[model samples]
Target: MSPRSASVNEELRRRSRERLLQATVELVGERGYEATTLADIADRAGAARGLVSYYFPGKRPLVQSAVHRLMHMTLSEALEREPVTTDGRERMARAIDAVLGLTRSHTTLMRMHMAGILQAEGFIQCPEQQRLAFLLEDTVTRYGSEQPEHDYRLLRALLMGAVVALLLPGAPMPLGSLRAELFQRYGLEWELGTPPQDEEPAPR
Candidate 1:
C-alpha cells in the first residue's frame, strides 16, 4: 500500500494524545493525584514512557488537561442531551447543572484539578481548557447576556466558586444548595438539565 496521507498521520497523533489524556483521567481518578505518576499514566495509555515527557511537562499539567477533557465532554453531553432546547435560560441552567454534577461524580479528580489550578502552577491554559471555556462561553451567550465577554467571566467565576466550595477539603458544601444558588442566580427552575439525582423530590 502507498504511504499514509498527512491526514492519516494527524489522526494517529490525535488518537495518541487522546489516549494519554484518557489514561491520565483513569489513573488519577482511581489512585488520586499524589499517587499517580507519569510513568503509570504512560503505562496505562500504552504509550512509551518518553512520550509522557514529550506530551506534557509533568504530572500536574497532564492531570489538568485530563480533567479539562472530562469537564468539556461532560458539559458537551449535557448540552446535547435528549429533548434539547433552544432557550438560552435552559441552556445556561443545564451548563451549571452539568458542572456541579461533575463535582459530585468525579470528586477526587475534580478536587485535585481545583487544587492544581489554585497552586503556584496556576491555570494550565491547555487546548482542553480552551475548549471547555468556549463551550461555557457559548452557554453564556445563549443565556442572553448583553455583554458575552463580561457575562461569561461572571458565570465562570460563580461556577468556579461553587466548585471550590463543593470540593473544599474538610468542609465540603451541600451540592443541592450550591446548585440552587447557581440556578437562582440565573433564574432557572429546579428541574433543568441533570438535576441532583440524590435530592428528594419537591412536594407539590
Candidate 2:
C-alpha cells in the first residue's frame, strides 16, 4: 500500500485528538481530576500515552479543551434543535440553558474545568476553545449587541460567574434563581429556553 495522503493523515490525527479529549472528559468525570492520570486517558482512548503529550502540553490543557469541545457541541445542538428559529432572543435563551444545564448534568467535569481556568496556566486557546468562543460571540451578535466583542466577553463572564456560583462548595445557589437573573438581564421571557418545570415566571 502507498503512503497515506495528507488529507487522510490529517483526518486520522483529528480523530486521534478527539479520542483523547473524549477520554479525558470521561475519565476525569468518573474519577475526578486529581485521580485521573495521563496514562489513564490514553488507555481509555485506546491511543498511545505519548499522543496525549503530543496533543496537549499537560493534563490541564487537555481537560480544558475537552470541556470546551463539549460546551460547543452542546450549545450548537440547543441552537439547532427542532422548532428552531433564528429568533435572537430564543437562541440566546437556548445558549444560556445549554451552558447552565451542563453544570447540572456534568457537574464534576464542569467543576474541574472551572478550577483549571483559575490555575496559573490560565485559559487554553485551543481550536476547541476558539470554536466555543465563536458560537458565543455569534449568539451575542444575534441578540442585537452593538458591540459583540464586548458583549460576548460580558456574557461569558456572567455565565462563568453563574457556573461558579452553582458549583460553589457548600454554598451553591439555586439554578432557577441563577437562570432568572440571566434572563432578566437579557430581557428574555421566562418561557423561553428549556426552563425547569417548576421555574416560576420572572418577576415583572
lDDT against true structure, model 1: 0.87
Stretches > 4 Å off in candidate 2: 1-4, 201-204
lDDT of 2 by residue, 1-204 (tens): 345687788899999999999998899889999999999999999999899999899888899999999999999999999997899999999999999999988999999999889989888899998999999999999999999999999999999999999999999988999999999999998889899886665454
Report the lDDT of model 2 for residue 108: 98
User: What TM-score would candidate 1 get against the native?
Assistant: 0.93
Best model number under TM-score: 2
Query: TM per model?
Result: 0.93, 0.96
RMSD list, candidates in order:
2.6, 1.8
Give lDDT for model 2: 0.93
**Candidates' lDDT values, in order?**
0.87, 0.93
